[model samples]
Target: MIRRRAFLATCGALGAALLSRRAIAATAEVLASLRSARQRIRTLQARFEQERTLGLLATRVVSRGELTVVLPGQLRWELLPPDSITWWITPAGLAYASSRSRASADRSAAGPMAGVLDDVLVVLGGDPTRLEPRYALEAALQPDETVRVVATPKDSRISAVMRSIEILIDRDLISPRRIRMEESSSDRIEIRFSDVRINQPVDPARMRPPTEPRP
Candidate 1:
């Protein structure tokens, strides 16, 4: 169960990675700018490719997925191809649906994921200031005008699961282009987003796990 908590926490960190890629000095002004930029966002939809490289694995494992986030607290991430799985974090609780099964099930209230579910949900909600209190932030400008932001966790709970997160943002577009998360165990996960749509109306149903009987 400890392993599961770590796994989900790492996965949830992906969403907030984009929040850090501001090309500016690490100062109050920079933090304010970041907050203002992300605050403009209300709804977001994007497709992402997550590549996980583990210390024990000789090759990277890649997964493609699409995610939808609706402000304060609703999110849905669906992994496609090789296997289909959907994870939903909503007002009610956390739930998941697997293609291999017919029912959408809710996570146990005291489950391992319970501890970090809010962390994941908040990241997906695109709140830039949400992580401010927990990480020491730094940003540098690139030759291409892209900003690289690095965030080191200040909280042991977060640092225990991962080392740090690095993000590259396209300054002109004011959007994140790449994110790399480093883990303590020498595992690395990189997520790249494409076809990003912001402030768009996403189907509410998409944020809810499917309700159907197991067949």
Candidate 2:
């Protein structure tokens, strides 16, 4: 009886090890597929709805926006009227303008939030390869034919401000459907994308930096 019990215990351990290996392998495969899909995107445009919850204030704010990205480093994010603000990120740097103030500010003026914005751009880009250097990624394939990726920051600066980021990608579309950024237990931001257009032509003027004076 003692010998039989020992054998069963050893088999259970072996089975657990095999299951762990399979899970790791599955995650790796999903990441590879994400990398391949992102490589094919040169230009993308989408509409987004963002919900921000402030931990301290216990307030939730919702905004609608449009995003346009031109590969090799160019992006324009505009929040539609009622909260009209736009941010343009290019090879030069980051710049933003507010419709209310009719003023523009450069990266130098963006302060600590600039880094956070830069990280947002990277996440929106949906390139796992670019994110892997700064984040530890784990992915799972969902029953709805979507891939869910969770990224935890490795950089101290980023980790200090962000807890983790979760991205949901549609397998058939090969593009991100939603992204959730957790800043803390109570503070977080969630963005959902729709009407995504891939490899589409975008107006050059839309991506041009604002000429208004810095605040």
Candidate 3:
């Protein structure tokens, strides 16, 4: 009985030590890791699968896509199947086109929405600097060496669109593996990325939205 009691005490002490380490980890450490990753990443190309769950739907909707991002603000997200469209983002605004019609729409009225979307994309694209000041950032370094960051928006307009955002980043790879966006309407959009390629030369043409006139 004495031996068992001693073993239990040792286990309890070890658990406490581990928990303490996790609890005391500094936010600066997380920030530094993010900064390091951001520096190493200039561009990102990946295949992603997105699942959107709605409050009333019995079945969740799933979509497959390819994403490309270049530093200094450019992104192309191409959706496939059912209905196909490609969304392009630039510093100016958002543009999208239907693959079937090949007609593009330049939605300048969507500038506010574009800003919010860009903010989330930039963070997931590995540059969190822009968001750190605008959002309350809480980060935890998990046992697997991945960092989980939860960001709550400080801006009322952004908060109105999204309640919060969560991201899982691979520290060693300096890449984001998943992002979950929680909308104020109780809808959830989760995107998982795979086959990621970073800093490789991307065609300049791919960076531009479709040239066809807006419909």
* Candidate closest to the true structure, highest TM-score: 2
Candidate 2 TM-score to native: 0.82
TM-scores for all candidates?
A: 0.72, 0.82, 0.80
In model 1, which runs have C-alpha deviations exceeding 4 angstroms? 1-25, 101-125, 172-174, 211-215
Instruction: Kindly list the per-residue Cα lDDT of model 3 for residues 132-182, writing each as its tens digit.
Output: 777877788889989888888998887888888998887663677998999
For candidate 1, write residues 1-215 as lDDT tens digits: 99999989987786466454332335445545555667777887889999989877667889999978887777887889775888877766677788676444355653444434455444443554566787776766678867666777787877777677777766643466677888756698898988878888887667766762333
Worst 10 residues of 2 by lDDT: 99-108
Cα lDDT over the full model 2: 0.80
lDDT of 3: 0.79
Order the candidates by TM-score, highest first.
Answer: 2, 3, 1
lDDT of 3 at 157: 81
Model 1: colliding residue pairs: none
| Cα-based lDDT for every prediction | 0.69, 0.80, 0.79
Count clashing residue pairs per candidate: 0, 0, 0
